[model samples]
Target: MSYADFARSIGLGGIAVDDPDKLGDAWGVALAADVPTVLDVRGDPEVPPIPPHATFDQIKSMTQAVLKGDPNAWHLLTEGIKTKARDILPSRR
Candidate 1:
């Protein structure tokens, strides 16, 4: 099926994706380039590929800023959320 049709059939109604592997690519880009996986850096067998960059305090501060409707945090938080939502969308159907 066309990715769009598959997406719609699966109830991924508004999202757009051209390729399945693109999700992994996007994750790599985001995890490396954009926001970074500031959460959950602990890896299998107990070794992490990248050291934790942001502390819980920093994360909490960002969360608080977001909840308080700070503009910069809004863009940052929504990009993180949208990237994560995109990662999970294909599994719903």
Candidate 2:
């Protein structure tokens, strides 16, 4: 059984999967609940780790899409890279 179901089975309060904003609200609800509570959040399960030579735009896009708007992920992805793909990669056109 899921965390929510498990919590409810034992007479505790819980929150189940929902949209991003709803998931945040669920955390608030879980915190405020008097009894023990569970906040079961669901999200993208296959976010890849940042690459060794990832670029600014590459890291930015990946952070926005896969990391769910995490700014720190972008910073980490681009930390030591001095140049972007546009600076080093040859244009196909």
Candidate 3:
């Protein structure tokens, strides 16, 4: 219920997974406010690394990709941001 409430609070009405029993990721997103991480953790060391603090180009690339004309592009961009944000987020420990 709390997850649903939080998700709704963030303007995600249908994000409530098929089962209402699942946990909401809103808290995690909020928790990741200060973290930096790559979106795909496929153990592919070849993926370029992102610094603890992202550079202007990084931010710009993310924003451009997200705000790009295509919705699919936006999704990809947002996911990338989410990934980077995960690594830098305060581990919540």
TM-score of each: 0.28, 0.47, 0.33
Better of 1 and 2 by TM-score: 2
What lDDT tens digits, residue by residue, belong to model 1 across residues 6-78? 5456554323334544555545644564322222221132211222465667757656766686546655666
lDDT of 2 by residue, 1-93 (tens): 588888898899978875644655688888888998988765444334446677678866765674575656555445423224434667544
The backbone clash count of each candidate, in order, is 0, 0, 5
Better of 2 and 3 by lDDT: 2
- Relative to the unseen true structure, what is the C-alpha lDDT of residue 67 in candidate 1, on a scale of 0 to 100? 67
In terms of lDDT, which candidate is strongest? 2
Clashing pairs in 1: none
Clashing pairs in 2: none
| Segments of candidate 2 deviating more than 4 angstroms | 48-93
Q: Comparing 1 and 2 by lDDT, which wins?
A: 2
